[model samples]
Target: MKKHQPAYLKSHSDGTLAKKLAAANARLQHCDLCPRRCLVNRQAGEKGFCGAGADLKISSYNAHFGEEPPISGTHGSGTIFFTGCNLRCVFCQNYPISQLGHGQPFTVRELADIMLELKKRKCHNLNLVTGAIYLPQILSALELAIKEGFDLPLVYNCSGYESLDALELLDGIVDIYLPDAKYNDPRMSKKYSQSADYPEINKLALKEMYRQVGDLILDEEGLAVRGLIIRHLVLPENIAGSEQVLEFIAKEISAQTFLSLMAQYHPAHLASNFPELSRRLTKPEYERVVDKLHELELDNGWCQEL
Candidate 1:
């Protein structure tokens, strides 16, 4: 929303961001950017399931403190909220932006300008939220931003249902992978998120994320400089039991994997139409998930104090 750059942004000496950005952009021709593989002619302004064409549709950009301690740090994580989402979770907290795709349409240049602006603000990282469909634009913007002088550890904030092919394109481009491990059960996915293959997709996608970023990298000040962080929001009625999710994370991925078990669930949008998830998560429900996670002995991450 505002233009600001930090002093460190001007002294960047990591590597050519344009190369990585090019690598990512090459994958967009067929547009297998996500598991959907919509393959629309994005270059010619063809809109896919995500609503927008090749142009970047951004809802909001700001410094956010609601993230994990490391990502948020003291200053805050510079967050760019991209409109439109691949997954349509019935209980989506940001329904207005995701479902509606309500935002300003920005070309790659304008998008890159936002990156430089964030750098000037002394933000911890460039956080891209719900950026699955706009990978091409993001890559182009990163390239432009690098040329104009902007550098910080990049954060790929996304839902876990991502294409391995798309993720492979982002091998070195993303420093921190913030993916939500939602819908452990396919039933909940089909009924709520509209993605019947959520479990399979999310599980496989998370493994790729772990393979790419591995464990989180913290700075000397204990802020996250790079790595993967998994977030799992506890839903009402234990339908998407957070316990099973924690167990799966411990068994499938590394036990040291960073996790955020959130308790901030409330019936939103069309959720009231459904009987089971018509209200907020109970305190006991949140505590039960926490207890199970502890019992599983997963050694890292935080569960918001319910």
Candidate 2:
């Protein structure tokens, strides 16, 4: 059976687009969407540590097969890779896009058009990747897309680094939450993503995501319709980082919730800059995380091999 998809446009007919714009405008004042919380005047053209102002910059947009099975499905996921991420991992794969900030500056209208174009290609949903700095813009575009008959599941494909204040704005918004449970250890997070508090913040953000959508709910066609799907990418070395992440998912969220374990870590962009992450993930490291997954007994979703 097809899962019940929320008609956000019909649900919020009264000034829906306008309200989203206003909210987007409001968020830039304090600017606490991601954990960085630079508190810079984003609206007044002050650049945050994330290197993003109110202007929305997109790196790439089109059908992408890099996502998990459910997200990419058969047709493929319509991914809009945003520019300038909150976390500047030294080993970032798409450093040119995320760090260099490639792509064009788009308004709400252009962003809405991209979403509509993706729906035209039979995309399962609009997968927003690395979009921490541009939540308000994405939401504003979503509002327009909804108004224009773009009715597909919205996928929040994010790194596990986000802010509660920003997430609170997406209360009735996003449908599928595909957040990565990246680093459980604070030292690893700081070394990699430059945030030592990643463990705590990611836990809190995961809780908020679970509260919005409980367990993963798939449609009759096996595509995700709503709910949360937490992803975990195993790194090389003993830094599999599975134990802490698994414990939190099983203990805090439902053990039955969907979990997608990733094994596609390679030396990309600035990986050479960081000695610890200067190479591809070894086979042994991947296998260890897999073994621990079974031990956790939270085998509820997809786990891909490297």
Q: Where is model 2 poorest over a 10-residue stretch in terms of lDDT?
A: 2-11
Over 1-306, each residue of candidate 1 has an lDDT whose tens digit, in order, gives: 323232223323454445555655775566667877788777777777777677778999999998999999998999999999888888888988998878988888899899999989998898999887888788777767877867778889998889887787677678889999887888888899888898899999889888887898777788886678999998888778577788888999888888988888888888889988898888888888888888888768888876
Best by lDDT: 1
- Pick the TM-score winner: 2
Global lDDT of model 1: 0.82
Candidate 2 error regions (>4 Å): 1-3, 14-21
Show pairs that collide, candidate 2: none
Q: What is the lDDT of candidate 2?
A: 0.81
TM-score of each: 0.91, 0.93
Overall lDDT per candidate, in order of appearance? 0.82, 0.81
Q: Write the residue-wise lDDT of candidate 2 on 190-249 in tens digits.
A: 887788998899999999999987898777777788889998887876453787788889
